[model samples]
Target: MTIRTARDAVTAAALYLKWLGFRDIMQSPERPASGIDLRAPGLVAQVDPTTCPATLRDVECLWLNGLSASAVSVFFSLAGYADDARAGADALGVPLFVMDLTGTPQPVNRPADELVSTGAGA
Candidate 1:
């Protein structure tokens, strides 16, 4: 589950979600039109494996997409999220995770912390 490239990050994120008990997870195609990287029943996820931190706009887009699907949103980032992004996600109730090189997801905020504690049902 080591994350050395962008593709590896996506794979790792998917595996992590599986470990969290999400079944039948669907990974978005490359250059997904919805900007979502993964989807499962009641869940929507985005993974950003670039050096730049995820931005507020990024989280908002995920949120909007999830809202359209009536699902909860989560984010995984390699370098983590911008300050504004964190604030926005917190207010929107989106869980944010910092993806470690080992592909482990570390909770970045209260919502994420709750998710980690509650796993898939969260």
Candidate 2:
């Protein structure tokens, strides 16, 4: 299955976030350079299509944005993340998610810790 609409992916990310107990989820403006794909109080997530495997640079941007906003960082890729991106998230404790073709979100790594905390605590 192929997802043609980025909005659809955003909505799906919102739904998945809702399942994860995020109540203030909303879509961010369409800014390819420096905008979050989705936002919730205390949380910020970016979504990318399967064709676009999220990279470390993407993770870094999200991490910085979240820090500036005083929120936890998250990333969602329909396909997956690069090795460095995974490492970066793990190092920084950013939650990484991958969505299916049907828009169901899957966590790439769920460390047994309670939450994806701030870098200071990570």
70 Cα displacement, candidate 2 (Å): 1.0
Q: Which residues of candidate 2, in runs, are more than 4 Å off?
A: 111-122
Candidate 2 positional error at 90, Å? 0.2
Q: Looking at candidate 2, what is the lDDT of residue 80? A: 93
TM-score of 2: 0.83
lDDT of 2 by residue, 71-95 (tens): 8887888879889989988888788
Alpha-carbon deviation at 17 in model 2, angstroms = 0.6
Each candidate's lDDT (Cα)? 0.90, 0.76
Clashing pairs in 1: none
Candidate that would win on lDDT: 1
Residue-level lDDT of model 1, residues 1-122, one tens digit each, is 88888888888988988888888899876958777889999888999988999999999999999999998898999999999999999999999999889998889999988888898986
| Top of the candidates by TM-score | 1
